[model samples]
Target: MNARTADKLATGMFWAGALTVIALLLFLIGYILYHGAKVIDWHFLTSPPTNIAAGGGIGPQIFNSFYLLVLSMLITVPIGLLAGIYMAEYAKNGPLVKIIRTCIETLASLPSIVVGLFGLIIFVNMTGWGYSILAGAFALSVINLPFIVRVTEESITGVQKEYKEGSLALGATKWQTIVKVLLPTAFPGLITGFVISAGRIFGEAAALLYTAGMSSPNLNFSRWLPTYPTSPFNPFRPGETLAVHIWKVNSESLIPDVRAVADGSAAVLIIVVLLFNILARWIGRRMQKRMG
Candidate 1:
């Protein structure tokens, strides 16, 4: 074939591939919305689940998801960020750095079900947390830690070396250079990592199941609080996440409109994840503009 013809064909092939991906994504999203829309309402979101009706809302499950998300982020972000900073700034080219990097990569690729099994053994069985919010959060943090570390490390590494050199050349110490210049430049990436981790934690079910048992319609705020001294050590407190609830409704519940409830929960989960991604992208862009 002529070079010109060949080039046109290649370009067309690329466009075709891109369009196919977009079309597939649109189809999946349309299917979910079509099935879920009728069940998405304030009442469905706020009310407790009922065995008699298939249309009962998932208020407790929603709350549990957010609660676990917050707790996991709180535990994972600081430690992961610090590890990243240490690897990028202090341990460059060292054996320790290589080991740390290898560990992070391995953890990132580890199966979610395996992590869940570990949580089941360690947090729920060994430590006696017993399928509570704390146990679930710990499990999620373990899964999220590597993402935060790798993202933070890459973000820090991406900060222009010239900026660090210039800061040091101006009589600034290494710590000052990192804290003032490098960190500010990498803030967008760190935020992006955090958002991604949050989305993952939100959708996670397998790991949570072993650590946080699937229980629904139990939204007692007192059970979640540490201030309640009279609360029992209810580790098997039957905490249900939105994802788990969907699975349960679809697989176990014989309710009449079970399909609608399952689809609606899935849609809500997807929307929440998407919102987090959009917010992260927006924040990253703003940070880039500010840095520029």
Candidate 2:
């Protein structure tokens, strides 16, 4: 066969694969949205679920999901960034560096279920935290840490060496150069990694199932203190996130509309994740322009 013929065949195959992927994605998304449209309304979103009610909402579970995301990210981002800075900046090629990288890779490769079990053992049992929000957040942080560290290290190291040199030449300290120039330039990438991590956190059920309990008490938004069962600030409380709620409803619910509830919750979760990704991308682009 002629080279031109082979090239055309390869090109056709690539386009065919791309189109197939797009079609599958559209079909899956459409199917979910259509099934969920009748059940997802403001009332469904803002009201708490009822065990006997035909049309129950997922308010508390939704709250728990966002709470988990925030709590986990709060713990993950700073620690990850610091480790990344060390890896990219100060850590020289040596035994310690090798060990650190090895550990990070091992952690990254670990299954989320393993991390969840670890959290269950340490954060839940060892610390007497039980199946609580904090335990779940810790589990998520473990699952997320390696990715954040890798992203941060890459973003920092990817900054052109010349930028650092120029900053140093212009009388900036190494620290100053990293904080002012490198970090700003890397902000977009860091945001991307963080948001993608958040998206994963939102969809996680297995990890949370083993960490955060499948039920939460009626949270009193009025009681903002840590000791109150209803207090949002009480990390020690067990809470069911949206993903876990969906799994629970599908697997164990006796409610007649359990399927509808699960579908609606799943759709909401998917939409939120999608919106988050889109928003992250937009923010990253804006930040990139600003940095430029």
Candidate 3:
């Protein structure tokens, strides 16, 4: 084919592929929302699930999901960011750096089931935490830490050198330049990383299966103290997240409304993940505009 014809064909092919992907995503989301919308109500969302009866809600599961997410993020964010910053700015390109990168890549490529087993061994068994929210959060950290670290490092390093030069020229120290200039400029990518991590944390079931347990206790939201056994904020309490609940309902739940419960929980999980993405993007844009 002539050059112009070849270029036109490639462009058409690219457009076709992009449209196919968009169509598939829309169809999947629409299918889930359509089915799940029928059963999602305040009662379903706020009441504890029934063992063998119908009309069970996933109240404790929802609470556990969010609580575990917050806990994992709280643990993951600072450690990941600091490690990424150190890797991007302070680490020398040497043997140690090479080994560290290798390890990170290895961790990122590990299977979720393997991570779950590891968590079962260390966080649950060795630590004697015994299938609790804290154990689950630590497990999620293992799953999410590599992604966040890699993303943060790449985002910061991807910033234009001009910003760093300008900051340094303006009498800013190295740390100040990075903190004030590079991170803000890289906010969008950082936010993307966070959203991706949040989605993974929300949807993860394998790692949490052994760590978080498969049953949530009767949570007492009125209990304000974290030390309380039934308190929502108690990290030591066994918490079955929405993802795990869905899995259990689909696989082995004897409840009569198993299908409805699973569908509703899946829908809520998807909605929450979408909200996290949208809110993170909005916050990132606002921060970037202010920094700019």
Candidate 4:
């Protein structure tokens, strides 16, 4: 083929592939929303689920999902940030550093089900925490940590070298320059990574199934004390999240409206993930504007 004709053919093929992907994504989202729309409502979101009843809601599961997201992020972000900073700023090129990076990559590539089994052994069996929120959060932290660390390292290193040099030339200490200049400059990317990781927490099931259990006890929303066993704030309590609820309903639930419940739960999970993505973009834009 002529060079010009070959180039045009390749360009057309790439456009076709891109359009196909977009179409498929739109169709998937539309399908889920359509199937679940009839079952989703305020009552469905606020009422507790029933074991064998026809009509039940996912209120506690929703609560557990958010609670676990918050708790896991609380544990994951700080440690990931420190590790990333160390890798980006202080770590030297050596065998140990290479080995550590290899380990992180391996951990990141682990299947969710395998992570669940690891959580079951360490968090549930060894720690004596049973299937509780704390165990789930720690398990999730393991899944999230490598991604966050990589993102943080990349974001910090992506900052312009001039900024660091300028700060240091102005007599700023290494720590001060990092805290003030590097982090703020990388804030947008970091937030994007954080939101993406947080969204994963909502969709996770296998790991949480073993660590957080398949059942959520009746929660006392009125009890604000974290120490209270029945309180939603109590991290020691068993908490089944929305993703787990969906799996349970579809696979083994005895409820008469199992299909409807599963559909609605899946829809809600998709919506929450969409919201997190939207929020990430918005925050990233705002941060970019401020930096500009």
Against the true structure, whose TM-score is highest? 4
Q: Where does model 2 exceed 4 Å of error? A: none
For model 2, residues 103-147, the per-residue Cα lDDT tens digits are 999999999888888988999999999999999999999999999
Q: Weakest 10 consecutive residues, lDDT, candidate 2?
A: 47-56
Model 1 lDDT tens row, 79-184:
9999889888888687877788889888888898899999889989898767677888888888999988889889999988999999999999999998999999
RMSD of each: 2.5, 1.3, 1.7, 1.2
The whole-model lDDT of each prediction reads 0.83, 0.91, 0.90, 0.93
Residue pairs with backbone overlap in model 4: none
Tell me the tens digit of each residue's lDDT in model 3 across 1-292. 9999999999999999999999999998999888999888888888898632564898889889989999999999999999999999999989999999998999899998899999999999999989999999999998899999999999999999999999999999999998899998998889878877997898899999989999877887899799999999999989999999888989996778778888898899889888887887787777778767
Q: Model 4: per-residue lDDT, tens digit, 55-166?
A: 5899999999999999999999999999999999999999989998998999999998899999999999899989999999999999999999999999999999999999
Clashing residue pair totals per candidate (backbone < 3 A): 1, 1, 0, 0
lDDT of 3 at 62: 85
User: Model 3, poorest ten-residue lDDT window?
Assistant: 49-58
Ranking by lDDT: 4, 2, 3, 1
Count clashing residue pairs in model 1.
1
lDDT of 1: 0.83
**Which prediction has the highest lDDT against the true structure?**
4
Candidate 3 has an lDDT of: 0.90
Candidate 2 vs candidate 4, lDDT winner: 4
Report the C-alpha displacement of residue 63, candidate 1, in angstroms.
0.7
